[model samples]
Target: MGKREHCRTSVLFFPTFVNRFGCGKAQCTGVPSFRIGHAGFLDRLVWPDLNRRLSVAKETIVNRSNRAGQIAELRKVVMWLYDKGRYHDALPGAVQLVDWSRDSHGSSYPELADSINILAMTYHALGQYDAAEPLHVEALELRRRCNGERSCAVAMSMNNLAALHFDCGKFGKSEELYLRSLEIDRNAQTLHNLGVLYHAMGRFAEAKPLFHEALEIRHEAPGENSSSFALTLNCLAALYFRMSDYAQAESLWRRALKIRGRVSGRRHPDYARTLNNLGAVYYILGELARAERFFMRALRIRRQVFGDIHGECAQTLDNLGSVSRAKGRFKKAL
Candidate 1:
């Protein structure tokens, strides 16, 4: 008889026959019969058949567990590299994470989206917008798929894409995405970004309220001394400087500088930015010596953080040259 027929016959008649004959170690011709409805019967009849299936299930569980641990470790390393500004070093790991998440089940869509977003952000930091844009688009679509259209995740993706477009000088597209993100979620970062976009467009009146709103939200959530709050303070100060409100600009810049100093110290790039902005304010106020000092400090910090060839260092050099010329030292300016 065929194997299928033999298996079907055994299943259909074995239990009744064993029970009726009370076959507990009973000998039937040359074969030992198994007792029905007992552990012995299951072990005797099914162990060989089920052992291979059980082993496969066990191996699958172990592999999944190992993959999950690997993903967790990758996330930690990727985030650490990003925080340290090691974008190039982080890129391979971020790409690996994306590939792994994509190969995972549909339940891992959120992980896939996160990996895509991080990879896009790393590309953006490297100024490779061509590579970054499609990744951001894919991340947004994945987030929308995993977490509905109006979710905070979707809103964050929208905000990131908007920032990318803004950097690319696609103002209209950026503004549209920013507005859509704000409509979905009243996030402090989104508010600040939209305000910055408005400020860039010279819409001072529109930008002011948004900046204030963002500041208030950040202050309430992360508190006034938070880096995010200091960032908004610096942005608003920049707007004030552009508007020629020197005193107000000086005050805000000073506060931001103090906060940054307390949080990140003098060697930080953020502290250098505040120093540069403060120097600009002093330059406008005609305090040439004070302006020169701030500019020098900013230049020193920028050189330390980004070396000599950075745009920030060049800008600080120009500011110093302006200070020298303003003090009637034309030779020094040159």
Candidate 2:
């Protein structure tokens, strides 16, 4: 097998080990699994630390124009920083690039508009909705001017704008934008985002197909470990669990758990989500012993990663209570 294929094969078995040992007790923190000796998104990508790359990308943006090559390279660098979880640090560089790309007097105005759209995304991640909204609007205008409403570029801007709307609880606006984006690409990410939006709105029936579609796409994609794919898997698993599809749910959650082990490592707070999902599946499967074990492990991880009182910890604690009750440990359940 090729190097990438080999990695994927290993990823496939990673969760089985996690199910056996339970994510290492010491591994839980906000840090991703890849950073903890497991190769993850950051390691898979070429970019270095967020702060360092931000500086370099900013400098490159200043010296370069809106030329296709420069713009593409700038995007690559900026995206890499975002994927590394350096949302805040990416902002300054992204803003500078947006400024250059948006200057109507320059030949690069279209590029600036595109850059602004990208900036909108980074801002959305950092919870700077006010900052992101205007950029999305500006990008929409530019895209319309350059590519018309039906073009793929317009669709891209719409999707980002929709995400912003979703973040702000504007489900209608977000839905409209996602539908528009879907018309253009019908891509996995757009579908996944749509699934999340639907889930948030309590529309599970509408959400499941999108999650399933994204999972299939990820399964076929190049990487063995991806946060997006793992997330989608978790979503599907949770959905199945909610519907009492215990067998399917357990299978999916177990798969997702392994990916989290390999991609996010055993200790990240996100891993707790996988653990909780898996624990719930075990609970439903009437494996109280296994359920209690997973819940306690998740609880410890959450406490270490998020400290006491975080919502996730509370949920983990509750799961522990449930498992205890199921085992007839009344005092512990209490």
Candidate 1 backbone collisions, by pair: none
Candidate 1 clash figure, as a count: 0
Regions of candidate 2 where Cα sits further than 4 Å from its true position: 1-43, 48-77, 103-108, 264-334
lDDT of 1: 0.62
lDDT at 10 for candidate 2? 9
TM-score for each model: 0.72, 0.63
The 10-residue segment of model 2 with minimum total lDDT is 24-33
Candidate 2: give the clashing pairs.
15-258, 27-267, 28-267, 29-267, 32-264, 33-264, 33-265, 101-112, 102-112
The alpha-carbon lDDT assigned to residue 289 of candidate 2 equals 88
Clashes of each: 0, 9
- Candidate 1 has its poorest 10 consecutive residues by lDDT at 6-15
Residues 250-317, candidate 2: write the lDDT tens digits. Answer: 89878877887776668754566677767777877788888878887887876665468555576677
Give the deviation of candidate 2 from the true structure as CA RMSD.
9.2
Tell me the spans in candidate 1 whose CA falls farther than 4 Å from its real position: 1-65, 84-92, 103-108, 307-310, 324-334
Q: Which number leads on TM-score? A: 1
